[model samples]
Target: MATPPKPTKRRTYDAAFRAEALRLASESRSTQAAARALNINVKLLYKWQKAVQTPVAAALGASLDPTTAAELRQLRATNRRQAQELEILKKAIAIFSKTDEQ
Candidate 1:
């Protein structure tokens, strides 16, 4: 009787490895180009790129230092709020000016 072959286990990538793969793929002309240079699968590199932008990564902010990442989040939120407020003021001014002209 012939012996059965052992099943291969799935490969697990560390955070650093995933980050480097993303950086290389992004810096290149295209993911395909980068994958070719790195000798990794194009689809796998594409998956890593998408994974970095996911909410889970944003929640953890794994790429940057904790303090800097937190500050970035705060600044982005503040800028968004300010932008909305500016839009409202601009619309109000436009409306009031139109009324005055009429």
Candidate 2:
């Protein structure tokens, strides 16, 4: 009986290279063309493209409007402030609880 061929191991790419590959994949070229240019697998490039493009898919071909950018920046700022406030509250509670135990 003939034995089946073994599958080849997948190559792992560094973060910087992966990011570049994704960038290339995001360009107007076809997946195969991008893969050829980037020296990566077409399937791998497609997967990375899908992962990175999920949120931006709707806006893929369009530029980001100023209002949208401003809203995103505000939301990120608010999130950071809330996180800082929560950390301070947690520290304050810990200090008070320790004082009460003494």
Candidate 3:
């Protein structure tokens, strides 16, 4: 009997990385070229470009005024960034605490 092949784990990217990748794709000559440079799939690059072009309010189907919607989007982005930073700090603290106890 033949052994089964192992399944590959799906990779997760944070908001910052996706934003930077989208920026690079926009500045590059072609999405394919950008994907090659970033070592990501061309289709994923195209999807990211499409996503960036879509407004968060519209994507969420929100019915707020333009200014409020824009503000909400900015606040959401800031919250995500802060939450990620907090996670990093928590992990760093854990590492330092472990070392201090050794």
**Which candidate achieves the best TM-score against the true structure?**
3
Q: Write one digit per residue (lDDT tens) for candidate 2, span 1-102.
A: 999999999788888898777656545357788899877778888777666543654464347665765476468669989999999999999999999999
> Model 3 over residues 1-102: C-alpha lDDT tens digits?
999999999888899889888778756778899999989898988788777655664476546765875676578789999999999999999999999999
Q: Please provide, for model 1 over 1-102, each residue's C-alpha lDDT reduced to its tens digit, 9 standing for 90 to 100.
A: 998999999778788888778767756778899988877788988787776564855666557775775576578669989999999999999999999999
Q: Which ten residues in a row have the lowest lDDT in candidate 2?
A: 53-62
For model 3, the stretches where C-alpha displacement exceeds 4 angstroms are: 55-102
User: Could you tell me which residue pairs clash in candidate 2?
Assistant: none
Best-fitting candidate, measured by lDDT?
Answer: 3
How many clashes (backbone atoms < 3 Å, residues ≥3 apart in a chain or on different chains) does model 1 have?
A: 0
Clashes per model (N, Cα, C within 3 A): 0, 0, 0
Candidate 2 TM-score to native? 0.44
Comparing 1 and 2 on TM-score, the stronger one = 1
Model 1 regions lying over 4 Å from their true place: 54-102
Arrange candidates, best TM-score first. Answer: 3, 1, 2
